[model samples]
Target chain A: MSQDTLFDKVWDLHKVSSLPGGSDQIFIGLHLIHEVTSPQAFGALKDKNLKVKFPERTVATVDHIVPTDNQSRPFKDNLAEQMIETLEKNCLEHKIRFFNIGSGNQGIVHVVAPELGLTQPGMSIACGDSHTSTHGAFGSIAFGIGTSQVRDVLATQTIAMNKLKVRQIWCDNKLSNGVYAKDLVLHIISKLGVKAGVGFAYEFSGPAIDELSMEERMTICNMSIEGGARCGYINPDEKTFSYIKNKLCAPKNEHWDKALTWWKSLKSNENSIYDDVIKLDASKVEPTVTWGITPGQSISINQQIPLLDDLAPNDKLVAKEAYEYMSFKPGQLIKDTPIDVCFIGSCTNGRISDLRVAAKVLKDKKVSKNVKAFVVPGSEKVATEAKQEGIDQIFKDSGFQWREPGCSMCLAMNSDKLIGNQVSASSSNRNFKGRQGSPSGRTLLMSPAMVAAAAINGKVSDVREFIN
Target chain B: MRSKFTPPIGKISNINGQCISLIGNDIDTDRIIPARFLKCVNFDSLGEYVFEDDRKTLKGKHPFDLEENKNSSILVVNSNFGCGSSREHAPQALIRWGIKAILGESFADIFYSNCIAIGIPCFTLPKNSIEEIQKYCHNQFLFLEIDLKKSLAKSKYLNFNLEIKESSRKMFLSGEWDATATLLANTSLVEKKFKELPYIQFCNDN
Candidate 1:
């Protein structure tokens, strides 16, 4: 009855053809590809005697399998080399632009797009990586696709998708100091549990969301996939406009005002109804950490591990499994757990601000001798900015190894990995078992500053303790 | 090993009972089984780790674990069930956990496909209906009527639509998710196609 929301407008505008299978062929506005997933997809295309339909719609970069440190040619790992070569060959064959290592542009796909101003509001962006929703921070409807879907996008510049209902997640009030977007999201996920956003698109709103920087908003929207939403986005605002203001793909000066006018018009109207609505208080959020294997199995840094008796009877079994796998004692303080390594990078929190925050903590302190600490930039652009600010020097001086940009140690697609059963304080998402590359590796999810503190203490030390 | 897909052999039991409500959001595959156990290509051993984080006693209290819900082929989950990464192992592990079907408000795209790729039937019910089902199940006995042949499920809790891809639905309804389709269709064509590849020829020459 009311005018359609931005989600509805974008979805209807992009609807190409509806198939009998109850799915719509939605035209993709922008397609992003990285090294690991694109290679196999391109190979599949080659096997099928196909070429990318619109190369211009697609952008390429090497991530997932690039080394953070010592990224020399013909990498020591054969599989890594093969993946890069295959991507190079595929991009060359298809005329797709590739941001390769040392290209001064190569970095995580999510990081490079924003820096280059490629990600704009009100666009449909798809990538072969799950964190593709990271682009949604700019008010775009972005999603991660599988290799087959990747091929589908490459072959047709479209994907078959079902429409998701809109869910407005309203966060009122300003966040206090020491609380970050990561903490806010962790709190939201914890409150919503793990399945609340099913069949829905979350429109993050309210004053707190409006005040966050574009990068901070990116961190919030990036993990929407973790909350089970098809995709999540914020309405395009002045902040969104300013973030994309004069870069590669953004509209020029005259067109900028026109774009803003149209973008502002796309916001959900007052009294607009949603299929679901979840409310949160911004000031209540604190630095959060995952005590169990799942993101939902998380607690505030000050809390102790939840004992089995504290959970529902049905949930106790899972609690026990987590306790066993994590080798953590029930009722023990999570902050005291020792860490063997500390990794700060991912599409999630690998931005320049994240580095600066960690650098601020590491300005005078040194990392523990037992901890293997490294800092990976999200993109080459972020790397350049970090260098310009001398943040890299600060990290190096604090014993944090400065490495090349890629999805290093996040999911362990690159040379960076944990050796064995080492527990790591990681800023990346998903602290699942062996997720950091080592078969027996352990990951403790936290903020970049928390990772820095852990690196210095070789334990799960709270960032607030060292903040002063 | 060029292993063929085998449809798991089990008795078909109608879970016409009231829904055992599972409430949560953004339930990821890692939480389902954790990434550590994914090293085993076969799902046999990893099935025990299903919901290992939430159902903590999976290792010690084997039969008491939620994995024990294995005997009950039907799973009733909350909204946004199976969100996060596009890992096929998520559904594979669920199937191995003896979940023949899942009823939820919604599922992650990749997770939904992974369920269909195997023989699992995932049906979506409206929220009101699911809530009603939960209420009914709590108060009295309720069971769902599932007719694989009719490709429809009926229950007091959920009467909403469950959309499945044409090819995938056909394969799942007929229990042909494994090599049945491949074997029933044609193998010689694939072999002949394989013969044309230089890589295959190189192997033969070697």
Candidate 2:
């Protein structure tokens, strides 16, 4: 248990009560809902004849199943059409704000919330989507919950939660040119295996973390779920305040100073106690990629997959599983491995900043004929912003498709899928077997810029090669 | 084929049922129930698809596919189980498959909360204690008694005190587990906070 970390402070502030069993009935400050996981929750509500308690706190949007190309009503897929229609109806019935498609406000739940300034410091955010932790970039305690708990929040606005132990993941100075926040997070997950953060909230702090832009911080916090932490957060600073100011729903001029004062005070004190602390040199991190089914089973872009003899006894079994499932030989460099698709989207890497990086690299290069690459912005705002900057045209000129924003190919929920046994270089989180739609399809998780490189080469190549 | 098992719902504390063991550690939620199955209506029928792929690869030899383990309600095994994805469908699939209690070395935070939310109590115990219990469960003859109120699990000369958070145990035993009723009754407290937060805006009420 942590004594004075930022997590402890936010948790203490939201605690409605310390229940008899040592758990706290913590009030959720924001409850974000999307099409996929929320239908059953609303169904559960209807079954109980319950109305949403504080419709003010709950927000709805369509994602997961919305078609990136054709998002018009009565979608091409019936199941998806029904899911979106149901969510729209539920939002209407429950009086929660819904950011519908083409609403300009619509996008991935994680991406839109922050841009609208709905996500902020010292608040507790819960969403049905696992990437809810992305909001933690704003210094809020955001984590994912299930549909039932989603229903719990919709009906009551609080959840019975046991506080998590806090771990300060101290990152030292600036990242090298080619390595972005995505690579840093992947390196962190690879160093600390996916299961290491199970009972903890990771407090990402230090010069390296503090220096990242708001979008970069979000990319790091977004994958915190992949690392198995309940949530990962960086304390709010000037960058955090500046990013939220002038946003659509941000605090007006009258409340600006008051909000900033509260946000600043929520940071962990210098003497704050933590359960454990780990250190890493961000400068040492290189472009990284997952070689196996799990996010933790990754190696640097130029590195080789470990041989069975090279792995710890406990890891050899999963290595064998990955080898057999992915049909790859050990001791071979991850670079130069052939890829069938290059996907640049999802809550992880679909932000405009990621697009700007990829587009810069792809400006004069033609995509390899053997590779099918596309970019899906995290939301409409990202798409609009990227287009305004002519980043979309750079990608389009390079033979990549510029689709509407949604979680396309991030999961198999929609039509954007990797066909049978097709290997993908993806910027999204998760490389789970069958995660990209095909039962035997393979997904190699990498940075968007790396995906841009793979799109040009038709194989996993170092992003640094394109940089210089 | 969808099995004809309508698992009991709510206010569950003590479980008296046979135990079944799975072979591996860190069985992820994706393995518990694949992402494709996540598209359906309520998770009631998710049981039929639970480990559907793993069971297919195991060629009907997986523990869940074994005829003798058909009616078993206690899942006994392993460390860091249910350690991926926040989809509560994993437990919903387990509960729908008739699993009432999970005895393991440890559980993932979100999965454990999902279980407790729906009255599925996940019991944590020492590793050796779990290994000892697995032997009995693997034999498919152990009819264990899990008493949540007392925090103990026992079956014929194999008795061990289980570790569950006191609040969780209280929730299960006293039927305060749902939390919907409790939260619904406290709207004023939530409304007050909503108004106090300067950044918050209330969308119109129906």
Candidate 3:
């Protein structure tokens, strides 16, 4: 059992009671609901004749199925319009606050919460989306829950769950230039196989973690689910405190001082024990990209795809499946591979900083005519910030489409989808087969800058070449 | 596709069904139900669309599509099954497709809980044992009688011990797997914790 770690502290703080089934009933400080998963949960609530217990604690947003191309009401897709309308009705009936499309707070739930200062240290956050772990970057105990559990949280502000074991992923050195947090996290997932985190909460620590900005930390924690961990966190520090200061929902004046004092004391003790410990040097990480279906089937930009013989016995099956599904040879180099679409968005890498980085790479250059490239900001605020900073103009000048927010093409819940077996260089988290809509479509997960590079070259090229 | 779907209810101590083996590792939720199918407001129509893409690719070769596996209710799969996405629709689709229980080498955390939440009891076996069962089912139908209390799955010629989290097993035995009621039982404690939290006192949002 992990002792005195930040995860332990936050978990113990929120634990309501031990249930008869040996699971702890943990209180959810923040419950985030989006259109896709929450409608059914709300329906269940209605069926059971229960109202949201702590309506103030739960937040609603429309994502997942929202069309990024059009922001107008009565969406082109009737099913999507119906889903969003259902959510609106539920939130109104339950008296819960909602961030509607034009609210400036509407975007991916993970991005909206942090920007609005709803995410904080020492809290327990739950959302219907797996990327809810993104809020854990603030030193909170956050994890994704299924719809049934979402109903439980809505009715009781608590859900039955087993405490996850904490694993300290200690990175020795900071990432090199051109190697962003996306590369570092992809490297971590590749190193720690996807299943390594099934029962663990990863605590990202040491010099490399501390060196990352709050947004970068969010990026790292956002992909924890891809690594099979429901929760991943960084201990609260000056960066976290400063980032939370003056935000919409942050505490004010004396309250802010009290919150800071409490946040400062939220880190793990010097001698805190972890269930498991793994150390790596982040400086060694390169701009990594996924070549296969699962995120773990990745390689550094310069490396060739691994042969089946090079894999562990346990990994051989999936590697074989990936090789066939992706239509790649065993020793084929991932670099210079053709890409038909270049997407830069999703909860993974759709923030303002991500847009700026991509825009910087795209400046004074034109996207390859063979590729269709676009950038979707994570939220409405992110879109506004990009426009004000001229980042959107830069992307448009480079022949990349500047689109509205909402999870566009990440899961392809809307019209933005990969046509047929077209390959895409995506900044989204998953590279699962058909994840980007078409049953045969392929996704190559990379950093936003890397996606820009691919867009410029019409193929997978090393981002460092551009940065250098 | 089949009859109207009836959800599992009450204490689930025994599950008797034929095994339908799905051979794969890290078979994700996206592959199970696909994102395009999630546009609806409910999971009622999700059953027919389960494994829609994979089934299309397999052209009736997928276990779920095979004539022999049509009525099988015990899904046997390999390690790290249901790896991505927290969508309960994956398990909901599977249960609606006639899966009553699952035996796998391991399951993803959120997917496992989702399975238990919707009353699908997921059990585990050793890698070798799961492979053997899958291999046996590939050639011929394997009927299994699973006793939750003993954590044992018995067939005509073979019997294997299953592994399940004690808490999950207890939840199944006691009908606490429908966790909303169980969680609501401690309403006072939930309210007390709310008041006791330090951030609740200091952080008042507008």
lDDT leader: 3
**Candidate 2 lDDT score relative to the true structure:** 0.86
- lDDT per model vs. reference: 0.72, 0.86, 0.93
Question: A436, model 1: CA deviation in Å?
Answer: 1.1
Report the candidate with higher DockQ, 1 versus 3: 3
lDDT of 3 by residue, A416-467 (tens): 9999999999999999999999999999999999999999999999988998
Docking class of 3: high
Model 1 Cα lDDT, one tens digit per residue, A98-118: 888888889889899888777
Which stretch of 10 consecutive residues in model 1 chain A shows the poorest summed lDDT? A16-25
> What tens digits encode model 2's per-residue C-alpha lDDT throughout A80-112?
877888888889988889999989989999999
TM-score winner among the candidates? 3
Better of 2 and 3 by DockQ: 3
Candidate 3 lDDT tens digits, B16-78: 999999999999999999998888888999899999999999999988899998889999999
True contacts kept of each: 0.13, 0.42, 0.88
Model 1 chain B, poorest ten-residue lDDT window?
A: B197-206
Worst 10 residues of 2 chain A by lDDT: A249-258
In candidate 2, position B117 carries an lDDT of 83
